[model samples]
Target: MKLYGSLTSPYVRKARVLIHEKNMAVEFVNEDPWTEDSPVIGRNPLSKVPVLEIGVDSYMFESPLVVHYLDHVDGKSFTPRDPAGYWQSQWWQSLGQGIIDAGIARVFETRRPLDKQMPEKMQREEQRIHRAIDLAEKTIKENSEFLLGNRYGLADIVMGVAMQYTDFRYPHDWRSRAPKLNQWLKGIAARPSFVDTQPPGFEPPAA
Candidate 1:
């Protein structure tokens, strides 16, 4: 399997981290979705990154679906098999993905020329990010160690990558606001999967 995405993309990072955690053998193909010549458009009509090619004429887009497929193939999915637990995990994943969406929007908005940038849109995205941080703090405080109860599963992986991306792009002092979540991320950051997949020039500084 080949995963096509940029290294700095949080969505792509989520897929890459899951692949490493599952110890799956897959090729990493760096592709910029913004470019017209990108191969991602061929695989996905939406022209999104993190498109997983399983076989000839077989492809999977969307980070969650790609991760789900990988987990299904490995037979050791991080998401709970139980219905209740599955939905709970999916809820957390949605929140994490929400953060990723808002952050990416903010990044792109800021990249635009000052006159062309939309302050209102950027403000809305910032508010969304703050709301996510508050929600994450509450969730982690209530459920110590991981997002879904005590297990480190898909929810935790999704949230962890989202936090890392925010830190890289926004550079906020979120640790003070969400201490538990910060510490939780610190532990996960030590994992080989995370360390190996750290975005280029965005790795956490030495303690």
Candidate 2:
């Protein structure tokens, strides 16, 4: 298996974390979806990051699809067998992905040349991110040791990736604002899987 994505992508981080936690072996290929003629386009027509090439025979795209496939096929199953647990994990996964999307958008917009950047749009994305973070912290406060329940499963992995991304990109003194979430993030960061999957520092691609 080959996983293709940049280290900066939170979605890619989620898939990477799951692969590590399940002890699955795969090749890591870094590719920029924005570059013309990038190989990711051939594997995933949508040109998305975290594209997984299963073999000469097949491939898959989208972090959620990769995650579900990994858990069901090549990796240990962390998703719940029960209907309620399944729904809970699904919902939390969506929530985590939403936060990642909004946060990434905000980061990318701010990176754009100041004359081209839209402050209003960036502000909206920041607000969405704040709302998502508030919800995540609230959920963690009410739930068990884990996001879904007692066991650390899919939800924790997805949300942890989002939190890490925020720290990497924003780093606006969030730790002091959300104590429970900060504590939870610290615990997750201590895990070997997360430590291994953590994103590398931002770097410009070779021209």
Candidate 3:
């Protein structure tokens, strides 16, 4: 198995962290999609990273799908079985993806030429991020340790990467506003899975 993506991508980092936690034997293929001739196009026309080559000519694109496959590989489950627990877990997963999406938008908007950048759109994305953080804090307050009641799962992984990526690509003054969320992140960051997969220049917040 092979995974192609850039190290700086939070989407790719999600898969990498899970692969580490499961000790999955998958080769990491470093491919920068920005290059003129990125190999990512060969497998994923969208030129998205975190594409998993599971078999000959068989590929899975998208971070959440790649993560779902990894989580279920080897008959192992990274989700709760009960209907309520499972759905809530899924909700958290969706919110985490949404948060990352908004963060990515903010990142690319800033990268645009100063004259072409849309300040209004950037503000909207920034607002989305802040709202997501508030929701995550509320969920953590109810869900207890981790995002699902102390049972570290895939949702937590996605959320963790999203938060870390925000810090790396879009620094914000959000930690103080959401103290519970901050505490949750501190514990998640200490995990070997998280520590080993951090992107270049990522510094964990002091606890």
Specify the highest-TM-score model's number.
3
- Winner on lDDT between 2 and 3 is 3
Candidate 1 — what's its lDDT? 0.87
Worst lDDT run of 10 residues, candidate 2, spans 198-207
Predicted candidate 1 versus true structure: per-residue lDDT over 1-207, tens digit per residue: 999999989999999999888888899999999987877889999999889999998999999898889878867889988899899889889998999999999999999999999999999998999989988888765427777767788888898888888888877777788878887888788889889999999958442
| Alpha-carbon runs more than 4 Å astray in model 1 | 205-207
Full-model lDDT for every candidate = 0.87, 0.81, 0.88
Ranking by lDDT: 3, 1, 2
**Model 3, span 98-204: residue lDDT tens:** 88999999989999999999999999999999999988877677425778766888888888888888888788779988888888888888899999999988886
Candidate 2 regions off by >4 Å?
A: 142-144, 202-207
TM-score for each predicted model, relative to the true structure: 0.94, 0.91, 0.96
Task: Spell out the clash pairs found in candidate 3.
Answer: none
What's the lDDT for candidate 2?
0.81
Which pairs clash (backbone N, Cα, C closer than 3 Å) in model 2?
Answer: none
Cα lDDT over the full model 3: 0.88
